[model samples]
Target chain A: MGGEFEGVVRPRRMRRSRRGQALVEFAVVLPLFLFCLLGALDAGLWAVQTSAEVSAVEQAAMVASSAGSSPTSETAPDAHAVLTSISGRLRSALFGTTIKSWCTTNASGDCAPDATQRCPTTPAEVQDVDGPRVVVVCVSEADPPACATPPPGQVAPYPPGCEDSPMITVRVVGFVASFVPPGFGPGASGFELPANISATTHTLRFAP
Target chain B: MRRRRRRGDDAQAVLETALVIPILLFLVCNFIAVMVQVTVQEQLNSATALAAQSRFQAPENAIDPSGTRCCGAPGMSLATAGLPTGCRYAAETFYGTMTTYTGLLHWLRATLCTSGGDSGNAAIPPMQPVAYAGSPSNAEVSCDIGSIKPGGTVIPGYVDRALNPPAGLNVVTCSASASLDFADTPLAWGVFWTPTLHAQAEALPPPFRQ
Candidate 1:
């Protein structure tokens, strides 16, 4: 017990304790570090998944807006069938198979945006919080054109072609489960940033 | 000497960890901001394009009657002033499709409706050109919509008579600009900068209707 080096030179036991203290600190910090990492991963995945769904829905809407798919008359191409392929491709990319298709036509059998017959029970509801992504495909015109002669949005009060043109809307709800916890990172209410897409196309001709 | 050196090393370790944590947090925030920007930009492109194309749905010479407004979000209508029925449709479609991330955007307003969209601003035809006839007061996105009259001498929104050939073909265009302000989001604490995103689109009249 030489008091000369009391403070400057510590016992080997003290040095060992210091090393142990470092180990303890690392142990405490490791889980927190790992948690932050996982949170980052969750956020990144969410962002990328959101981007994917956006691309998918927009593409589907574009297809529906294009000509030949719109029913100027019942004789025109079937809208449902035309959009199914595209929707299916969208499913392959992000959404699931069975896209909830909706239609609204006037009682007169003319297409309109008010049809709600085929709309799902909760059109905006996310069925499962953790699996099987739910996607909704809403069309201003019925797939087969209730009467082709009257395009969507055309009904009694308004003239035929003067009515609003057909439009297609695609929505992705509860896409990809949220990996983050209840209070970690940034998460939208439904675990995903729901994308609402409505696109329509109109044709024009040149004059001589 | 050894004990003092060890204390200095521990202090250094603590400092490094403190710095690393904040940097990682920043990376996460920036990544989210960039992703949001991309998504919004893409949606804007689609919306503007759809708006241009929707203008053609109205009659060739159709014009919005006096005191007309427009379609907005469901249950909500926008007072787009009297313009063209097609213009209203364009506004409706544009507003409807660009639905996500509205709160995060600080729009850079331009004339809501353009003659040939933003492209019509430049003189590029066999005649005089006008960019915007009028626009909605609070319109965010801008569109270029013009009609092809039966006996019109020169097209208003024509791109290039020489390049497009023959006489002229009308083209519709649209553009929207906005700054995605991330200062209000949850991740904003770590984010420092707000980025500006701009999207534009154009469409030609579909065939058969010709």
Candidate 2:
């Protein structure tokens, strides 16, 4: 019965095999185009990331600069705070979380040279985006621009004026995933690693 | 009959592919051009931010000593002669960051240095910008720094930038908006649209410096 059914087999269904080379080429080329597309997309996202961090740091420094010389560690709110706040509810990270650094006074030299170490050592992610990223603040100023003893007998005025200038620096550090093959984005050779982007800014502090 | 029909199908396949390959290539070129534009936009944002932040760094009272700031990309150096030290710094930062792809870009021209547009800008019209007294004529990248020498009284900048939305934040800001064109490049054949990219940043003024 099986032989009888097989005996009636029709002509081979070889229409797909007719364009076997085209099918093979498509298979080879599809991945290449997709990879390039991803790289292009990543470039846009990278710009967004950088802009967000810069905005965050610039705003924080501006706010803190107004705090006067004796700034009491006012680290700008990260994305989580933004997500919860009234004004910030409308503003949230479009891609991933922003890991803002707790501002440090007179500690510029201690910042990690590596971008990866700058954020939380333990990687954090929201969806495909990495976390513990964004602004790092460093305040540089003469510890006390005013005299402690007030020249022994001189009457020290309230909120004494400082002759010294102060500077506040903010830095943005971001890690982005790079899937584009070699000679594409981030990687010098191989791919599949998080690309590090960082920029540093320093401005004279605003002391009211 | 079957053989003749197969030849016709092959010819049609070749014709379809011939029509498609150029379109695909043009699409890819546009993609790459867009990437470059994104990067340039990022640079513009950084430059503007630095310029705003730098305004604070410059002494509140100092005017442009050089009467001309030096050191930006060659063409972009936009004779910032007779502008504020702050404006000079801003120009340098802007031109400096825009070092790459200068030839490929067709920037939206603005007055190199401006002061006293407090009356209004194109955004909040009744638009009358205070004249840029000493800024070179060929300058692009217009910036308004409050006002200058109005009735012989010079004002450095406003506590609140008149150009900014009146939220009263009193923050120093840097922003840049410009269009990128690849007309001079071979890619121009494929990329037609010149995208305008923009970014603006703000920081609070220093208590003493302001």
TM-score to native of every candidate shown: 0.65, 0.52
Query: Cα RMSDs of all predictions?
Result: 8.4, 11.2
Model 1 segments more than 4 A misplaced:
A1-25, A28-36, A39-44, A66-83, A95-114, A117-124, A128-132, A140-162, A166-168, A178-208, B1-10, B61-77, B104-111, B116-140, B145-169
lDDT of 2 by residue, B1-210 (tens): 555766887788778768766786687678777766776676566656655655555555442221223223334435454344556645544553344346556554443343322333223222222334443333335443433232533233342234334321234445556667688877788898878777675544444553
Q: Which stretches of candidate 2 lie above 4 Å from their native place?
A: A1-22, A32-176, A180-188, A192-202, A205-208, B35-39, B63-82, B96-111, B117-139, B147-177, B183-189, B198-204
After best superposition, candidate 2 residue A88: deviation in angstroms? 15
Model 2 chain B poorest ten-residue lDDT run: B63-72
- The collision pairs in model 2 are A62-B204, A99-A133, A206-B206, A206-B207, A207-B207, A208-B207, B67-B82, B116-B146, B116-B147
Error of 1 at B71 (Å): 16
lDDT of 1 by residue, B72-121 (tens): 32322344434455677676567766666666655433345434322222
Error of 1 at A159 (Å): 12
Docking quality of model 1: it rates as acceptable
TM-score of 1: 0.65
